[model samples]
Target: MTTRHDLQTRLERGIAALGLQLPAGAVERLLDYQALLARWNATYNLTAIRDPGEMVSRHLVDSLAILPYVQGATLADLGTGPGLPGIPIAIATPEREVLLVDSNGKKVRFLREAIRSLKLENVRAVQSRVEEVEGQFDCVTARAFASLADMLAWGGHLLTKSGIWLAMKGKHPEDELAGVPDGYEVRAIHELHVPDVGGERHLVVLGRTGC
Candidate 1:
């Protein structure tokens, strides 16, 4: 079992090694997140990252790396299983509002618990399908939630006219983008380098054309 201090140290070192600067209080919030995740995962199975050390790379750092790129007012994390990038992002940018939505009751319960435990005033957990939710978010994120095209279609209506759609994908997402509906345009493709993680990670940023 890893202690909280150990996890924090690993997070600090990983962030420094990745050449990423985290927002103040991020470490503490992530620690709380890890605790809540561990507790809920006992039954809810929110995430596979049961070990604290692994949580640093798989959960904390992996989620935080995208912070520098999402410059928007309101953000939504679609299918956020146990609050991946959403909870971390909310903690990082307390001023920016975020919504974490998932269709699973268990996942949403865990997410709500995490929000309460972390005292994350900026995050709201919604237990509904992304397509059914109503809101105009400046940015909407989908992390390992669904295919690129499917996620875009489901979240398209939730984004502001000029908003961006951020999809955190694994290596080789071209297949997912191939079926994208004709409308939005791929604005940027950012390859993420997660500290101490293997394989390839990428971010696909899409933009709507005609509202």
Candidate 2:
């Protein structure tokens, strides 16, 4: 059993190396989330990774890898299946309110349970599609969700005037970016380097321009 202290040390070291700051006690809550995930995964099949250590690197750490670039006040995670970047980001920024939306009932149930177990008051797990979730947000994020253009189309309305869309994608998103809707602008494209995971990861940040 990996204790919260263990995860704390790892998270602290990892974040420091990456040059980022997260709220205190994030490690404990993250560990709690991981525990809940493992327990629920048995029945729900939410995530493919089962090993705790692998979960730390692949799910927890991998998600936090984008911490260096997220800019916003309130964030909404579209298609937050099993609460990937949403849960981790919520833990990192305890002050920022985060909404995790998913259509799958089982995944939403697991997300709600994880939030409760982690005592994450800032996180709201909503069982709904991205389009159904109303209210303008400072940032909308997705991981392994949809094509870049599709993500923009579905989550566009949720963004505030200057709000951003943080879409995490694999190696080449050139084809996907070709069809981006008219009003959004590509702010930046950052490559992620997860410690042990082999593959090219890119974080595409799209901002609303008054075009």
Best model number under TM-score: 1
lDDT of 2 by residue, 1-211 (tens): 7765676666666666666776767777777788889888998899999877778777888889988777777999999899999999989988889999999999998888888778888999999878788999988889999988888888899999988888998886888877898988888899888765678899998988772
Model 2 TM-score, 2 decimals:
0.92
Q: Which regions in candidate 2 have their CA more than 4 angstroms from the true location?
A: 1-13
* lDDT accuracy of residue 170 in candidate 2: 80
Using alpha carbons, what is the TM-score of model 1? Answer: 0.94
- The candidate 1 region of ten consecutive residues with least summed lDDT is 14-23
Cα miss at 3, model 2 (Å)? 7.1
Could you tell me how far off, in angstroms, the CA of residue 32 lies in candidate 2 after the best superposition? 1.3
Query: TM per model?
Result: 0.94, 0.92
Question: lDDT per prediction?
Answer: 0.84, 0.85
Q: Write the per-residue lDDT of candidate 1 for residues 1-211, one digit (tens) a residue.
A: 6888888888888778767666777778788888778877887777877777887788888988888788788999998888888888888788899999999998888888788877888889999988899989998888898887788778889989889888898896887777777888888889998987788999998888664
